[model samples]
Target: MAERKATNKYYPPEWNPKDGSINKFVGQHPLRDRARKLDQGILIVRFEMPYNVYCDTCKNHIAKGRRYNAEKKSIGKYFTTTIWSFSMKCHHCSARIEVQTDPQNRDYALSKGIHRVLAEETKNDTVTSTYSMTGDEKQDEMRNDPFKRLEHLQEDKEFADEEKVHLIDLLEFRDRLASADYQNNSALRKSFRVILGLLLQNFCKD
Candidate 1:
């Protein structure tokens, strides 16, 4: 883990000044609790310990007195987009720790080990969905069934070739999720969750 410097000397090409505005999407919903649990592994409480501080290198005790700056940034490549906080400067040492926080509740600390847990859950979801697709044999059978085949063909004809390609791209995203090694990567896991959520939301709407 890199040290969280108070000043960001350089911005990566992918960084966007406008990306911060996306945090407004968080809102109250029946699904919000479930989503938070899926991402963080516990039901988030409103009134709890606000911020936790730790030495980044040794993971030792650090003074809780000093306040560090909180920056919201988008991370992960594919299936996730986490707007998480980066805490800098341990009072005990010059170490910096990066922590995950709920965008809705900026002060609360998500459980320490929730990232890998969520990643595993996401992997299982992808595997289950893929397995349900039933391989080429079932697809062939579906093609042979008169009514089902008509419906399938009708849907294909209704969508342009580019739209069909986009659908394939979406399924490929599932493949990416299934293939990822989430054990060592909390950030990747977060990104995957966000991507999966966005893809599913778009798919359901379509």
Candidate 2:
């Protein structure tokens, strides 16, 4: 029964050893149902959401890492790399969503039926609760208040001057350490150690 089951694959009347592989003779793809649209150059695949997106038709939120059965096909090529497209349906509203590979940017782009959720939208509000001013807030304050902008400019100038002084001090310290006399002393000490070790070995042998 096992042997019969193993050999249960159907073969058409024209099928023969000389005709080629069994899949070619049977007019079926090796991937079976996954290649149902092989004639159209598309294949069924399991695709995961690359990032958060909102369904345009139903306004439903699709989180990143969500998996779906998608249709995949090579749409074009960027140099030697082929760009692929994935088309899937949203679980909540059954709305279609299409995403394509952006080979140049090394990311995915939404082709249709969906909108991406921005990083700022997904960020927690509590993250900015601290009193320290962020770059954006500082820039906004500087733009609105001339006095604040002038103060910031003065602070920047002071900081740059301090950095320059520190850099000059470091260069002086480096120059002192790398002096010709220092290099000669270092080499002399290294040779003295080698000579002392050889003398100690001879004394021990004697």
Candidate 3:
């Protein structure tokens, strides 16, 4: 068994040192089965799905990170970036699926036998905007009105001042909590114990 796994491979009768290497002498690629499609410029590769997709034939969900033994080949070029295509079969059903690299969009695209599962946007998913001008009309009106601009500037300054005061208060509160005087207090310790006991009671009830 150890001999079978040895790095020193047994050379065939026809193999000669002048022939360069055993793989070249036998006219077989070092990758063996993986290089079967070498003539066609395709190589067998282990590919993982970049995003969630539904198998078109079976209508089954093939999740993102699902892996498959796929045939990988260069399909095209996108500004010096080589676009690759991966062809694989769905494990649920023997349906062929083709995925291609989308360099322009910096993502992957389904070419055949699979449909992308697009997540629906929700209110919570929407980004919270920072500015008060929620629309183009309001922005245009604000730009035209000097008084509104001055008011906006005043509001920004007030908000900044409030935030600064709040941050300072928080830091002072933290400092007070961390003080040696606070740590040495038996009254605070008893209060904390009572609070912890109440919390535990509430947690156990839940």
lDDT of 1 by residue, 41-139 (tens): 333332222333344456564433345543334343233535544444444555544555544332334333112213233222332452244456657
User: Cα lDDT of all candidates, in order?
Assistant: 0.50, 0.86, 0.85
Better of 1 and 2 by TM-score: 2
Off by over 4 Å in 1: 1-49, 56-60, 63-65, 76-82, 103-206
lDDT of 2: 0.86
What's the lDDT for candidate 1? 0.50
Model 3: how far residue 203 lies from native, Å: 33
Please give, for residues 58-78, the per-residue lDDT of candidate 3 as tens digits: 999998899999999999899
In Å, residue 39's CA in model 2 sits off its true spot by: 1.6
**TM-score versus the correct structure, for each prediction:** 0.22, 0.48, 0.54
Q: What lDDT does candidate 3 reach at residue 13?
A: 92
Report how far off residue 128 is in candidate 2 (Å): 21
Give candidate 2 regions above 4 Å deviation. Answer: 1-19, 119-206
In candidate 1, what residue range of length 10 has the lowest lDDT sum?
113-122
